[model samples]
Target: MAQGENGSIHENTGERSPAGQEAAQDTSLAPRRRKPWFLLVALVLVAAIVVLIARKPKDTQSSATAGPQIATIKAATAHLGDIGYYVDALGTVTPVATVNLYSQVNGTVTDVHYTEGQMVHRGDPLIDIDPRPYEAQLEEAEGTLQHDRSVLAQAEMDLARYEKAVTLQAIAQQTYDDQKLAVEQYRGTVRNDIGQVQAAQVQLSYCHLTSPINGRIGLRLIDRGNTVFSGASNPLVIITQLQPVTVVFDVAEDNLGQVRDQILHRKALPVDAFDRSQETKLASGKLLTLDNQIDTSTGTVRFRAQFDNNDLTLYPNQFVNARLLVKTLKNAVLVPSAAVQRNGTQAFVYVVTGNTVKIQAVTELTTEGDVSAVTGIDAGTVVPVTGFDKLQSGSTVTIQSMQAFDSGQQRLERTQDKSGSTL
Candidate 1:
């Protein structure tokens, strides 16, 4: 046992041992060593945090100084003009009249008078059936008629003689009565014979087929030398009137009121027909009529237009894009259709003032081809027609070309001034 100043015991090397003193000294030194390490680590962590915090503002400032962005766009100037607002619809060209000519008599086809696709006038003979049989029948009917008439005349003469003889009592009364009956019978026979003659003549006329209307004939369904019967299933030929054609189309029912007004006013609304691509004008016509009823399933109404196709520009069964000139709006603010943008139900246009753009709400009245009529913006206002994706309110824009806007405005003003002076 060793006694220490703190009155503790040590079992090893039993002298007043130095172990406790050394352990006490070590324990005091351990805290001093750990304090520097902890302070160094803490100082390093604090310095890193301070450095990160100090750099944040400079990074943000550097980003802020990168400069404002600008977008390039194409712009067009709105102009006042006479914009023809039209109702567009799909249509089909049809002939005014189509006639399928059929043989009306049982006879061999004797002649094809018209060529295929030949234009013919009314009463122009198109086909001829063998007339020999019909002619013979007519002759037979005429002979029977002549024979009955002669017998009737003879019986009437005999009846007159018998009546005179009965009065003189030179002949039996029965014979006179018989003679009167014979005369009446012969007259009835003669009337029947006359009917037969007329019927035969009608059949004979049918053997020679003529065009019922002025038209272009289609292909010959039956060739010459082919036997054609009355009421045959196939027609001898088809004739379609082509000089004046018609177009039938369907229009949205919503526009029915305006169309009916035009009709009631007796306004000859013009209808222009174009090819399927709607690029070329095929023909010009007048709106003929509107159907009696609307088609419930399609929400549309059918309309007919008549075209004087003197140049044969319209062909039957051809598909066309029809534009009915419902009305014309004068002094309308028209712009390129591309300039308009829609956000939900709101339509807007971006008008460029100097280098910046501002939003202008517009009501799109009508769109015709590449141009649109809009309200809420004045004519001659410059609006961007393209590159709208990069645009926002107050966005800076570099115009690729300003010539269109400038020139258009100038031209429009000059025209209006000239028109006003002329008026």
Candidate 2:
């Protein structure tokens, strides 16, 4: 029985040793098998990298598809014209002749022949003063003159008789001499009475107040039956000549040389007068005269322009704006007023070179209407009018539409429009 048990134990030990060896082999083999899992993790990481690389190209492609923002430009060119240099000033329109009607004699206003605001001619009666008292005084003086004339006639006859007596020695020398002296005294009295009568008659004729000039009359200050005196403070009416009006204005002393040159050259300094709004021209005239002396206080010289105001648009004492044409430049390069940009004292414009924009400096000569006369730019030079604010020197500009640019050309083409027509 002991031998049988030993055999069994040996067998068990042998089996257990084999199983342990197999377990050790399996443990070693399991690590070897996990190497594939590590490789799978590495493969997954590689694939993620590949996906990232592929997405980068798509993002880059999308970014490449977008374009840069662009701005529009208006290209224009310059032209030549007769550019006028004008000096603008404020002024007043006054009548060539202004008069205030007043009474010459003291009397009641019996009649006003002219209506208020009526035009009157020279020597036209404006007012009539009461002449009854003056007429009575004249009549009294005339009667005294008649009586004196009769006395003088009788004395003259006596003088004649005395002269004859003296020559013939029929009368005493003293008596003839006395008769001649009496006749001379009577003649002197008659002359004095006649002078008084003539003076009274002259005074009676002064009852009528006449207009001194051809003009339009203002409101009447005194009505009929209103007493007026020669020494009254205010006039009965004010009259202003309207046919020829004068525009008075002041010019700066700095412009005196140019004005003098214009006059010396016999160039008609065209002057235009506008109303208070400075919109419509009331009348056009030539420079008539410049004051002899400059005003020291204001440092300006006064000037006058005369206009035939037959239309009556210019009223006396009306405030006006005057434009004095100083000089004209022939074949001057002019650009639209909108194209010129001012920076401090400098003027500049944007010029288009190919597709790039460049800022060009310019000097202004004069401005007329909507155009500015400049010196730096030449004809056929493309200048940008709009979208200049977004531009810098050497910036690329894309013209958005030719039609939009053509509108500016249309403005130049439409100069003959009815609204722009002027006399």
State which candidate has the highest TM-score.
1
TM-score of candidate 1 relative to the true fold: 0.75
- How many steric clashes between backbone atoms does each model show? 0, 0
Per-candidate TM equals: 0.75, 0.71
Candidate 1 C-alpha error for residue 23, in Å: 39
Candidate 2 Cα deviation (angstroms), residue 189: 5.9
lDDT of 2 by residue, 1-423 (tens): 688899889887777777788998998899899899999999999999999999999998888886444668775677766666888888989789888766778989899899989999999988888999999999999999899889989988988898898899989999988888888888899899989998998888888778889999898688888988877788889999998889999999989999999899887787878778866667778899899999999999999998888788888888999989887777777787778888899999888888888889999877755677887889767777778768888888887643222222233234325223321
Report the lDDT tens digits of candidate 1 across residue range 220-261. Answer: 687889998888898889999998999999999999998889
Candidate 1 residues lying further than 4 Å off, grouped into runs, are 1-61, 151-189, 403-423
Show the lowest summed lDDT stretch of 10 residues, model 1. Answer: 403-412
Q: Which residue segments of model 2 deviate by more than 4 Å?
A: 1-69, 144-198, 265-267, 399-423
